[model samples]
Target: RSDPSSFCIISRLKIIKTDISLDGTKKVLFELEDGNRIESVLIPEKNHFTACISSQVGCAMGCKFCLTARQGFIRNLKSSEIINQVIQIRELLDQPEKLTNIVFMGMGEPLANFEAVKKAVNNIISPDALNFSRRRVTLSTCGLVPEIERLGKDLPINLAVSLNAGDDKTRNMLMPINKKYPLKKLIDTLKNFPLHKGRRITFEYILIRDINDRLSDATNLARLLKNIRAKINLIPFNRYDGSPFEEPDEKRILAFQDELIRKNYTVTIRKSKGADISAACGQLITGP
Candidate 1:
């Protein structure tokens, strides 16, 4: 058991409640150290919905573009804590449709908290309990290769790698994790990934101002995906205080998208919303 003193900041933090306008969309904040909290989102999208889940209290990935990393690592969230987010989302959801998707796209790296994440995933995906479809669930990683290869065999959940920089030189400076698990090793791991038919690994590329946001970067990106079945998601950077990054201009972002389209790769540009409320993907940190 962890010392409560370690969780003092979190313990003092009240799970400030919020009621949604949509059909039964309600949530509460989960606190961690240093007044840190993670927001649970039960988005009532179309027919099937999704739960935005957190794996760690804070992140050590320290990506130049992410707000969570700026907060620093507190600790890995327990399996029950991870499971609680889903249980709460399920309770508040009063719609006719079920929660079909669960994303490890919140505060911390899911793989960094491997055992807990894996167990929680198994709990929900098991034949009993919530019985969530593994395909609909996605675990986002900063390209943790060993864990990635491990998960490939252990579970059937989808994998999304944060590959913001197309090449190593830029990637290493942008995402420190890339220095350890470079593109070649990451892709090779993915190339051999045991994804079932109809499932393609996702590559999430965030576009920063003039940095890793060029045409050649997109071209080089295409070369890197040579034989891998991957979907590229280009996210325009979302700015927050203490983050040393700028969102790429609209024209530049689209031009980069067009280049990837020219390469005949399945490409998507995700326009981020909820930044005003600090609720966008990778922006969740402990706050009011």
Candidate 2:
């Protein structure tokens, strides 16, 4: 009765569907006001949880292995939409405060929607908001060079590059953006990024069988990233229907990681999670 119209009410996105995987991964699909949909995944760790959020409804970069790219460009998500993903996921957990990590690896290239993505990051780390640690928040991009440089200048958060291919020709085939920035230029930009002490940029390399999984590819990748303080996350390709690539055998994937370790590079093979529900890396495609 006390001036109800005076109070502001922000509209929340509608949750279209929720699915829990056998591995305990939870995916929530939210419908935007304009009818476009974006999905976020809540991944539980040993004691904490990580929220993988999206920055765009669909992707424009056209990474050959990504399902979101197949949806093409719908539009950039609003900062509110991006921030709401974390909030909604946090609300789903038993110990909400333990959701300690956030990754911008769900649907689109975060750096492509630079301004909104930056605003969302600020809100996520702000004391009045989610109150997340800057170190615990990682933003992934597909090497949008200028935007990447700007992000480094504006924020101290962790950065991850979706570097699926080691060389230009192969990279150009897998990710079209490589043709614009190229490997050398992108590496140079990252090398010059202002990273804090004890922190290394993360490079995500997805290994496709007979494509970018050869030992020579690992050697070239090791050489390319030697100058930069970086750790490698090797993802054995997660395949979907109509997808041309195949995930490498476990032995081949480990051999690739060992080659990097022998070269004195820190590497980890990312275990594919939620494959049954298509909620793993490069698999967040929203259905009509």
Candidate 3:
């Protein structure tokens, strides 16, 4: 007979509500065991779906543009809580296998909860568990330098850095973490990060009007990442209540992308999805 103590019991997160955007992006609100809530997004792609999961209940990084930061830091989720998000979201799809990609860009800084995230990633890619391809899993961080170094050694999964500004002064105004890591030091770390052949690190730059959206900022960005193998994702700022930023005009956005493309950098403008339901990037927050 098996000992009861030897069996591990996993408590599931309750699905409190779900909101679907016209674009087919579904945002799920989950109630944790302690009644604290977190949200996840199911993004429908060309052929597959990507699950954007959260590593922490709320965020401590305090980026000026993020709504999640307004809630302040709650607690780091357990590895089971993190993995269960993917599992439950996948279960909602008609063809679960189509849910292939997993991105840690939902609510909090993933590296802030490194150990739990590492354990979750191991299970996410383990053949006997969730069995996801390493290439399809991406973890986005707000320039957590030491954790970024540790992550490279601990997991070979895809990495995406939220680099909203090219210079230290502007970055410090946007993400408070920049004050500690700074732009030069952070770039230096990324320059030495281990990447598999043909795999480039993704730099997520949120383009905010009159802030980090100027032509000079784009040039500085190009110069800053000149040495690293990088692909840029230009995200137009998604405005929420009380946000002090606005998205740049379409022409300005194009010019920003063009500057990078002219410099021989791969760039893509990430379309704002689920905004109608308040599920777009940096728009996630729990409670009414």
Candidate 4:
């Protein structure tokens, strides 16, 4: 019921849909009652119970490599829209149990719509309802520091920070939110997070060719993550329209990942999946 707040109700009710199968995981996209849309992913491993949910219609955090920003900010989804993404996908895909994992990594900056995101996650983990564990859910953000720290105190779910750059100058260019919060402030907030050192903090670094893939950047990133209990997921750049950025060649990417491992850092190179269907890393949809 949470439609784009600022838009007039004169907007037509149109629905656009898409489905993706990645690494044998099946997902269906749903355009809801509101002008916004959301997606649900059914991973075979989790009995197709995994659903990656979105908290907002369009993203306000305009990451340079993202396609969702083109549609701009619509509105924050209500608790129903967020929960329905799971229900609709199950009915369409015939895998209701497959809606297991709920990730706030889809269309918008989740923390920007924190209350809705919190309500949705609560429904997901509620004993009388969808009934998922906090460990099975993850929330992704573009380094919203104060919000990040707030989540540590409130939510028990896994957290992923879209850490595209190790330094401020590089990050500011890749993600404009950097100009406001900056890397140092982000790190300080992470360090002060209620989660202990042993618990993993996922740093999602999308490797753009010649941008964040160099050996020096990798080393510098490892240095920063050293103090925090971090697991870095190096995501290959997923291209979108107007983004001149290119995914780094595989060999170079492997080398850069190796450099981090050599530095005694826990790192993993996430294979680029669903790019062929335009549902990869930064290719999330905004609306109908």
Candidate 5:
């Protein structure tokens, strides 16, 4: 037998609690060793489930529309902590094989914790490890330009950019990171990103009421992404307590989608899921 004192076994994340939404979405709260907590969401798709995992305890990028930003930046998670999220979530599934897709759209910015995310992603897609297909794994970012370039080179997984606004002024008001890397620089980087055959970059636009939901905004968005191979996902703003934003009405939402379709761009309106449990996009946050 090996020497027991050589190394100590680090404990995995403890599951604090799980909240299931009316629509079948499951939100799992995990407590880390340091007593900090993070959330991971299990979203039920047509035939499979998608796990939205966190890369950081809290977020540094203070996007006005995101609830996590309210918590401020805490720290980046270790690679093991990142990968453990997937392992733990999978174990909780009755049919674990049904969990097919993994999205880094939870609490923290994945690119902010680049090294750990890269390591976790490598393990995620490695045949001997998690065995997840690269095509099924997606990482979402709120426009971290340099990290975006680096990610393109290091990882070949699907990319989803959170492009909530069409113009710089509106974007600046929504996502503060836009102040450093403006819209022009972001679009240019995405245009140069290498993609495998039939793969297109996904642009996520959160349509907040009377803010970035106008038909003109949609027209501007179409112009902004004209040259890139892109598919747009229009996510209506998900509201939370003390949030200053509201979701646009269905009429306005469809009008925005119509404008993009009229411009020959493929778009889908993402249905707000798990809002009852606060597990929807931009609604994840953990207490200090």
Candidate 6:
């Protein structure tokens, strides 16, 4: 017979609710034992689905455009708490096996919670555990230079930097982390990242209208990323309640991308999924 006491020890976090976007993306809210809440997103692509997991209950990075930053920092999630987001979403999926990718792009900067994130990532790709392939997992950071170096030394997984702005002035205004790491240091670190053959790092840029979508911005971004094997993902800003920024016009978005292409850089416009339910990029704040 099983011990009742063992069963009494419950998970630190529990699913509170899940909201589905018209586009079919799922945003699940999880409440911690102490009542703090965090969110995770599941986005479906053409061939497979990707689980966007969180590493912190809230974020301290304080990016002006990110909803999570407004919540302020709560605490780093334990490895189990982080992994549970993935496991729970997998269980919720009608076709769990279709989950082929994982991105640490949800609530917190994964590198900030290094040890716990590392542990969770190991189990995620471990043959004895989830057994996901190395290429299928990605960690996105808001340009934490030292931590980025440490991650390159240790885990060396696929990396994506949230390079939302092309210059220091705009970047500093948008992402406060830029004040510390800055663009030069962050780019230098990315240039040194140990990428496998033909694998490129991803640079995510959120195009906020009248903010960082100008052709000059694209030119500067191309120059900044020159010689670095990277593909830029242009995400038009997803507006939420009381947000100060507006989405760039579709024509401008394509123009910005075309400028980068002219500069010989590979770029793509990322479709903003789950925007209706407030689950798109930079919009993962806890809600009612």
Tell me the whole-model lDDT of each prediction, alpha carbons only: 0.79, 0.89, 0.93, 0.76, 0.92, 0.88
Q: 1 or 6, which is superior by TM-score?
A: 6
Write one digit per residue (lDDT tens) for candidate 2, span 190-230.
Answer: 99999999999999999999999999999999999988999
| Per-residue lDDT over 81-116 for candidate 6, one digit per residue giving the tens place of the 0 to 100 score | 887787778877777888889999999989999999
Pairwise TM-score winner, candidates 1 and 5 = 5
Determine the backbone clash count of candidate 1.
2
TM-score of structure candidate 3:
0.96
TM-score of each: 0.88, 0.96, 0.96, 0.88, 0.96, 0.95
Candidate 4's C-alpha runs over 4 A off are 1-16, 22-27, 43-49, 92-95, 196-198
Off by over 4 Å in 3: 1-9
Worst 10 residues of 6 by lDDT: 1-10
lDDT of 3 by residue, 148-238 (tens): 9999999989999999999999999999999999999999999999999999999999999999998999999999999899999999999
Cα lDDT for residue 43, candidate 4: 46
Q: Quickly count the clashes in candidate 5.
A: 0
Instruction: Rank candidates, lDDT, best first.
Output: 3, 5, 2, 6, 1, 4
Residue 180 Cα positional deviation in candidate 1, in Å, after optimal superposition: 1.1
Two-way lDDT contest, 5 vs 6, winner = 5
Q: Give the lDDT of residue 222 in candidate 6.
A: 93
Give the per-residue lDDT of model 5 (tens digit) for 1-288.
122123333558899999999999999999999989999999999999999999999999999999999999999999888888988888788888888899999999999999999999998888767888999999999999999999999999999999999999999999999999999999999999999999999999999998999989998999999989999999999999998899999999999999999999999999878999999999899974
Residue 230 accuracy (lDDT) in model 6? 96
32 Cα displacement, candidate 4 (Å) = 2.4
List ranges where model 1 is wrong by over 4 Å.
Answer: 1-14, 19-28, 32-36
Q: Please give, for residues 129-206, the per-residue lDDT of candidate 4 as tens digits.
A: 667777888999998888998798888889999998888989999899999999889998988777643578889999
Q: Lowest summed lDDT over 10 consecutive residues: which window, candidate 1? A: 1-10
Residue pairs in collision within model 3: none
Model 4 C-alpha lDDT versus the unseen true structure: 0.76
Higher lDDT: candidate 3 or 6? 3
